[model samples]
Target: MFQPWLATLLIWIPTLVTAGDPAETPWISLKPENHNGKHIVFVTGDEEYRSEEGMPQLAKILSKHHGFHCTVLFSIDAENGCIDPGVLDNIPGLKALDDADLLVLFTRFRNLPDEQMKHIADFVESGKPVIGLRTSTHAFDIPNDRKYHRWSFRNDQWKDGFGRQIMGETWIAHHGGHGWQSTSGIIPADMKQHPIVRGINDGEIWDPSDVYTVRLPLPDGCIPVVMGRVLSGMNPEDGPCEPEERDGKTFDKNNPIMPLAWVRELKGSSGKTQRVFSTTMGASQAFTREGSRRLLVQACYWCLGMEEKIDGKGNVSIVGKFKPTSFGFNSHTKNVRPKDLLD
Candidate 1:
């Protein structure tokens, strides 16, 4: 009864399941040498700003240099099982959040299915620390009929949804000139001592990404740590944006800079307070600068309540080869799977 064709069919079954199924897409894992005992799960899916590239490198830095176990999940192209930010609905491996100490979210306008989305919802309810990067403010674009519709960025029923309720703000506007104007991080005089900015100095952190507008005086209990000075050009040394006249009023873009990074203590459904850190700066190109990388690493420490370990001059070096693609729509590297990033 051992037919030759049956053996061939059995051999192909495993390959078919592995290659055709997006839900079985592999996630990148980085084990810590020093072992800090904390696990950080980075969920990256954005059509622009290359969150897929940036988050993996951040995970490496945290894992190799800082002693934390890191897992990076990507949106998978269901057709070929490759990483595709445009594939907004299928970000597998979110169940890793169940045991994660911190969740680094950098998605934009995703509408994941209920089962996958439930993991994120449950994580939030557990009152765990969350680090939200650029575009994360408008992370979900779920339909009203869905169970997780309240997580949508513009859900009126939930009053601006996840971004507003958890991170303290939703997408407002591009405060700075997109692409043309860049951002220079400025630690406020009073906030210089904050643990999140302990290793970063005023004007040291510069990101090619422009500043995003936030409704200010930010929501209650939220503290702005770093202010963003809109620059005239996309260089770190560029001068501040010039004043413009609008409706008989002169508007100075940097006279009152926007908050580049902020922190909040949010009460979760579990009635436990969770640390939330939100930053409008995390473009792939931004991590090329040491100051920008340091800011994020420091923020991770602060989020974990390990502020005592943050050194102003600590290591936040790039773990491996990283030449990030510039930010643009449909700009992600095609056909690349998560396993391809390990090299």
Candidate 2:
């Protein structure tokens, strides 16, 4: 039997209940707004693992503030502290690859059923834009399956999993002390003029709580967007203990301490091209302020080819904490500031 939420979502179909709007109850908001022709979908629900945060709020922000037509899909079952709210089973009015402009995914150590996975595969095959956060790369789990292996960076089913191959890294432990650190001396000079990076500068940083360092190479055509110097004395989530002697050391001895955030154009086997923007870090509360927020908003606009529209509006700025609350969401106030890419 289908769960009540799943059934309700399905019944509502193309008509979705706006999270906070009573008037738009049980109906998807399809009204023509600034994002009239744009469609963005957010897949969230990994709460059972580390923390259930970010994804849902990201969708809401894009929808309400940026005027993006957004849909958020949660997992059906909550397993191992990971929530798999079973959204795929409902289907609602959702169809595969129906003019979707972007697919934003954030899942943990959970595998989607074959049918659900197929829907995602079909969507990606459509050659649209994709943005993944944190555990999204290795979000699934299915050993002894070639299809699942391809999504992982490391062969060990217990280790690298799917995230490494797609987003370029699995979740390694944080090197910097808990909380956030301001990034310095890492912004790409060449990309300084790029609108997506406009207003971002040295010493400006987003507080994504903890950032992951990629241990593998990204797909071809990937461009580095930001790089950071990793502080030393960090341990993998389930790896060996932190070195007692390395407590104050600010650099990793086993690996290069430089971490990167990037964008890429991927060409799949089907000859379709997809645009992707990945960052090792961008979920911290600090990111919702100053240059970091501006960079993210610009990146979204650029990905949607709406940079021109945003540019005509002058500078763009957003303020708030990007961190998710107990309800797994956050909010931001947008303010257009001047574009100063070189800054």
Candidate 3:
């Protein structure tokens, strides 16, 4: 489902600079002069769920409101230089990772080259912080024959790939109806005092995206923050459905929903137990909600060891207008370059 680009990238690569880095790939950046020295690099390359649109908005909020330098890289059609999620192999600017204090990734089954992937592997192995959005659980879908196949989402040697080992879980199934059923966040009554969920409340989490199913007990070190309750309707105020019973156990559906947002502590090759924030939410449609954006912003502070800086009333407002398209395969805006995102 590759859409052909109207113009080749060679015609625009040299002249495009959203953040002025001048890389020959589709990457947008925002550097706030008011500044925290940390750099946040966002990787977006999912064919569905519009990570490309969501990531940029997030970078804008972080840069404008919080003073962090942000860079967003996309999947590229090498020949034409267009941003194409269908083209999984090429995502320029992994070099941005080397200098990044944090990496926020939202990709699905990406089969990147060894050269590009090595950078990610180094980052994870080094124990730096990271935040994974929907689909990133199974980010790399490399073939077994490839040198970096060990990083694949469902690889045998790695025991469920990057998402499970590094983050929390790999791609599982959908607990609710894929498109028809909506989900809402139900904060644990006891964890309300936690900084990440400080300003958030019960039933405030609403998204058109369905809830993702994960096995009980995420990797031993993970802590569940907000659980996703399957709603009978799409609206934020929709009532949650009763849990379905199976195999002699009555599942209390919304009474005790699936953990959708969580944090894990894993030891990296650097002998440091770095923080990892993994969430099953955060598509473009989901980002339209202020609650979801705030959760992720809080996570950035938690991951960077700045939980002390979190305030219940911190600014997480969107920097510009964000009218994102519905999530679907082959639904991205075409004939646009990385520089186009600046406008």
Q: Number of the top candidate by lDDT?
A: 1
**Predicted candidate 1 versus true structure: per-residue lDDT over 218-324, tens digit per residue:** 99989999999999999999989999998999999876779999999987678888999999988899999888999989889988999998867778888667999
- Model 3 Cα lDDT, one tens digit per residue, 1-343: 5444635544333222355443454788777766788889999999998898888888888887787888899998888878899998999988899989999999998999999998888887888999999899889999999988988889788898888987789988988878777888888887788888889888766778889988887779888999998988767788886667789999765554689899888877699988999999866878878888888888998999999989867888876567888877888988667766765
Model 3, residue 242: displacement in angstroms?
A: 4.4
Q: Please estimate how well model 2 matches the true structure, expressed as its whole-model Cα lDDT.
A: 0.50
Which sections of candidate 2 miss by over 4 Å? Answer: 1-32, 48-53, 77-98, 145-149, 156-164, 171-173, 177-185, 216-219, 229-257, 282-287, 309-323, 326-343
| Model 3 weakest 10-residue run by lDDT | 8-17
Q: Rank the candidates by lDDT, best first.
A: 1, 3, 2
Q: Can you list the residue pairs that collide in candidate 3?
A: 9-80, 243-253
Better of 1 and 3 by lDDT: 1
Candidate 3 stretches greater than 4 Å from native: 1-17, 21-25, 242-252
Error of 2 at 226 (Å): 1.3
- TM-score of decoy 1: 0.92
TM-score of each: 0.92, 0.65, 0.91
Deviation of model 2 at 201, angstroms:
2.4
Q: Distance from true position, residue 74, model 3, in Å?
A: 0.3
Each model's lDDT comes to 0.87, 0.50, 0.84
